[model samples]
Target chain A: MICMNELQLTVDIYALVITTLTLVNAGAVYMIFYEMFKRFYGAKLKFETPVKNMMTLCGMEVTDEVKHLVPVSEIMVFTFRKAFKHITESLTSEFESKVLRDWFFYALIILTALIVLSLIMGWY
Target chain B: MTDLNLGIVLVSEVLIYPGLMFLVATIIFTQWLWRKIAARLGFRRGPMKTGPAGVLQPMADLLKLLSKEEVRTALSSKRLPALIAPLGIGALSTVLLTTPLAPLPIWSPFDSLVVLYLILWATVSIVILALSTPNPYTNIGVGRYLAFIVAAEPPFFISVLVPIILASRYYSDVNYSIYKTSLYSSSLWGLNPLTATLMLLSAFSGFISMMAVMNIKPFDAAEAETEIYWGIFTEFGGPRLALGMFISFAERVVLPLIYTFLFLGGSSPFTFTDNYLASLITTLIKFFVIFSILAIIDTLMPRFRPDQAVRFLIKYALTTAVIALIASITLTFIY
Candidate 1:
């Protein structure tokens, strides 16, 4: 049977670790988005020429998305779209490969377990 | 002893002096060795003329850095957290004081694990602050650094835990103080060949990965000069550069020392009649041995592309970490 003090210390350690991991992961996510934006700023675009006779701006690909997304007039709208894009890329591993991303997630899961265990078992 | 009285004395004498001195020594040693290694690799004598194989080279470099003019671009974000960057690094290094530098009972705090995580995040905070400096190269460097940190940290933490778990199961006392727990020669796997190999491999692999995380060599993409002009350090000059350099060196030596203490047999390698001096000498020797190996590798190997390097660690190095953990888990039942 554990004393209240030891149990409280264990709980406090868990809280500390989880909070730290969450913050670090948040930072990682922010960096991923930041890198995407930096790359987008420098990325080249390709366009197909449109005929004057065509009523539509066919093949022009002149949607707002074609332009830089960071400088949108409505900040919230831009953020939503950017966040969505980032999630899609991260999930599908479109930026890299799905397999590697899954493995990374597995490693994260194991790491989280280790941290929690350390806190509970008090492996200081 | 009263907790208040203990904390005060410990924070000042135990924390401040030795921690600061170690940081200074690490900076000096790393700089001198880096120059010597670079010169040797390039087939030139580096600083041999300065003082006995240029042992005083670090002192000269320190003076040079101090004498250089501190420059900040006029158009930069003047309201930015300039001091935060270096202060954060120094603070992060101070967290190492919580680690049992010697096997002394007084040194180990109750929340040592928490302190370790705090140290890492503090270092990352410094990285974020450095990135926020509005320098384009710095931003790119920070991006790469964040990715590496994300990729490397999970494996690093998990790997460290294997030894901890293996060591823990052998504890004779369920009421053992966390600091008194031993991993050395306890045979967490109890002489099982396969499990022993797995544990050793995990410990070794995790250690090398940590070295890479500390940016020792071939895995050093964040500040690869050819890829980006000194990487995140492109715009820093004068005292700020000096601080960054010091932080890097401190990180290099200290992280390796922690790894050595935790995983590489700790004080068992030396039977110190004079306990304090013996432990200190043991630590310094172990530190240099690890640093020299890294320096040689840095000279011998070519830097990897960021993407390729990330994949390689995830695929190969991390597998070894998993293997170690699994072996420990397996041995838990058998033993």
Candidate 2:
């Protein structure tokens, strides 16, 4: 019969977790990012007229006045100002803020634990 | 055990009883129970025609969905990960083998980690299926699901872990096994004051997370039919739709079954180690209670906007879990 010791099982469990989360989160992250790109950068990426959705649902910046101000999709406004602006707006969105807050909260806990462990392991 | 014995165990435990087959049976029955409860609460009749008071309605619905014509939208391509939905079912089934429901349960030290991962995978599988269709409504649904996942999953992971952690401290052999934890979960309440409080907080957080993860009312913005046209399944039809729906239907049974065991002390009045059938009956009774409560809550509550749902889950469920986990870690030091 196949069996594992407690230590081996612990290692196996962590391996299973790390691998699964890496895969699942990578796909979810990509899907969300791709959807955001499609929604926000649709007109600019294709050099087509942007759908400037002025009515913001959930207070998101669906309308891009920057597209109207730019003479061409290749202009510097496209390179620096619009890209950063969109990033800032997206980051500042309520959804993004909540998500970021959760990430920060989790990261703080994990990092604190890891640092304590490191000190214990390396203390002379 | 001999090879023949091992093979029998695998087939009986994993395939026949309390595994894939049992999960299917549970889903069929619970779907009926859910509808019946919801209907009664709403002052309506549920599925009285399917099979002896609508016992087979979920099955009939599945077959009907399977028989429908496959509608492929212009957006749906061969590139989408349609196969993932079944894999979600596979994950759910695999996790069940580690619970007390299985006669010869499959287990290992710290295997609850894998169980938690599988539960998360089931959610991911649905999201990946939704992402296959790149429509505006699908995108919005996917966004809402993402927000909900981010808000709900960690709290659940941490909350569930509190039980396992506390249980491990109580028993040398517990080793974070789901079955082991469930066997002694009720004892956790009587440990001391800190653990009792932690259990209360974690259980509350876990229930809220479970509601969000199941995508029921007040947290189902991802599937808000009026707004997003069935949300993530906007472009899904035919076999794909059936499989997507099957994954969801299976989850309604699977997650609650796990919760009943982990939190409600699986077969508490009767341990499986003593009498398997008695324990199984007790487990079923507990599962029904939890299933009914959740279903009634679902029927009574209205949908929350995606943003509102995420914010509430984070503020309440997530905060409660964090406190619970920190307290659990501290309690370990005390003991």
Model 2, B1-335: lDDT tens per residue? 68577556655554456666677778888888888998999899999998898899988876655555444444455545545775677677667767877666666677887789888888989988876655566666777787788778999899899899888877887987876898899888777655676687788889999999999888888788888678778767655676787778778888888888878888888988778889888988988898888998999998886656766777678877887787667655654
Top candidate on DockQ is 2
Native-referenced DockQ of model 2: 0.04
Over 4 Å off in model 1, which ranges?
A: A1-124, B1-8, B14-17, B49-52, B74-82, B99-112, B172-195, B271-274, B330-335
User: Model 1, range B1-335, lDDT digits (tens) per residue?
Assistant: 46465445434432344445456656676778877887898998888756777878887765555445444443334324334444445454454443445222222223435545655754565575555444444555666666566556767766766666655556654222223332243343344444355456666667667856777666787688876667657666544565566556667766676666556655555532246567667767776787787788888889876655565666556766876677567655653
lDDT per residue, candidate 1, A30-109, as tens digits? Answer: 23322233244412322334421121112444332212212212422333344345556666756456544577557656
Q: For each model in turn, which proportion of the native inter-chain contacts is also found? A: 0.00, 0.01
Candidate 1's docking class is incorrect
Docking outcome class, model 2: incorrect
* Second chain alone, TM-score for each candidate: 0.84, 0.96
